[model samples]
Target: MSKFKKKAEVKQEIPTSSMPDVVFMLLFFFMVTTEMRKSSIEVKQQIPKAAQLRKLERKTLVANLYIGQPTEAKFGTEEKIQANDAFISTEDIIRWVNEEKSKLAEAEREQLTIAIKGDKDAKRGIIADVETELRKGNARKVLYTAADNSNARKN
Candidate 1:
């Protein structure tokens, strides 16, 4: 009869002491892996398609220049040049380039690159003007951004 009687069983519980550490590790991983652009683009740009494109290795050394028409009606449909968050005139390009260049270390100034992202339908003269300004500013390291054309290669 005594052997037939069963002993009380202890319930096992999960240890949650390491749960917050695991959650924080995941948060830190996402924070470091995700890319967040510092500047907001106000213009609408439909970049031209090209067969070749290269990704910039360091984002901090790159300055983005956007050329396209205003997205809002109040700003008009005329094409404009956007540097960082502001709509800059062609004349401002040189000053903007110099400012961006100055932000980098002297040794890294030569490594700084300007990424020009222009709309497919934007005026060619505008692009030429920007390029001229870049050369004048001695910031000649320029990269033109374009969409990858997958079909072009196949055809």
Candidate 2:
């Protein structure tokens, strides 16, 4: 009975040294696979619905420009242009485009496209102004984003 008790006292414990390694692997996997939002949108933009819409193949090559009314009442109900997280004037569009263009490589400059997400009720003149600024900055590639209206009848 003493010998049996001694054998029982000598117990083998499962090693947990690799537990941290396993946890770290899972953390790394999620970090690599997750798509983080690059910028926070401050404006409220209800993009127009469209029957046909195509997704951008490369997210890195796209810069988002949001146009809509301010989400907060203090900012007024008038429509505005938002670049990154702040409201930008039409005159500032040129500067914003240049800044974004500078971030890209020379070869990639031509490939970079500005994705304009304007509200359905926003003024068309503002859209045209944004386009003109884009051209002035030598960033001519522009993409207008619209919500997919999959239920719409095809002609």
Candidate 3:
């Protein structure tokens, strides 16, 4: 009984609900807006080992070619050609290399590198063709695709 009831009165109100709904809405929003990562292509080729394998950070061009033994269909069966018959066409190589070179020129990008992905069973001559085309395109750096250790052990 001091002058006017001393301290009036202190009141506190607890939240009834709605907090769970708010949290659920926020979680759903984030889940809906989240971005899904794209899948990367598998590198399918055999690379020759080197004592010094330097890693390159940037790749300006990627050339994909399918080189394999020619198959001839006979009596509903596929007949594989001999080793000497395996080859990649020269015209195709030239076209792909030129395309990559033009891409670099159009983008005005420097420090261009060429990445060649070829079939593992492809002949050396086919790889040589790719290299020659790259040289003509004036590509200074080159990277070759290779099979992983597990895949190598399988073969």
* TM-score, candidate number 3: 0.43
* lDDT tens digits by residue: candidate 1, 1-155: 55545333445679999999999999999999987968778888898898767888888899999999988889999999999889999899888988998999999988889999999889999899899989888888888998989677864
Q: How much is 104 displaced in model 2, in angstroms? A: 1.3
Stretches of candidate 1 exceeding 4 Å from the true structure:
1-32
Please report, in order, the local distance difference test score of every candidate based on alpha carbons: 0.88, 0.86, 0.52
User: Clash pairs of candidate 3?
Assistant: none
lDDT of 2 by residue, 52-118 (tens): 7788888888888999888889999888899887889988988888788789888887788899999
At residue 16, candidate 1 shows an lDDT of 93
Best by lDDT: 1
Query: Quick one: ranking by TM-score, best first?
Result: 1, 2, 3
For model 3, state the Cα shift of residue 48 in Å.
7.3
Q: At residue 127, what lDDT does model 2 achieve?
A: 88
Model 2: lDDT to the true structure: 0.86
Runs of candidate 3 with Cα error greater than 4 angstroms are 1-53, 60-66, 69-88, 105-110, 148-155
Model 3 — which ten-residue stretch has the worst lDDT? 76-85
| Cα misplacement distance, residue 68 of candidate 1 (Å) | 0.1
> Could you tell me which residue pairs clash in candidate 1?
none
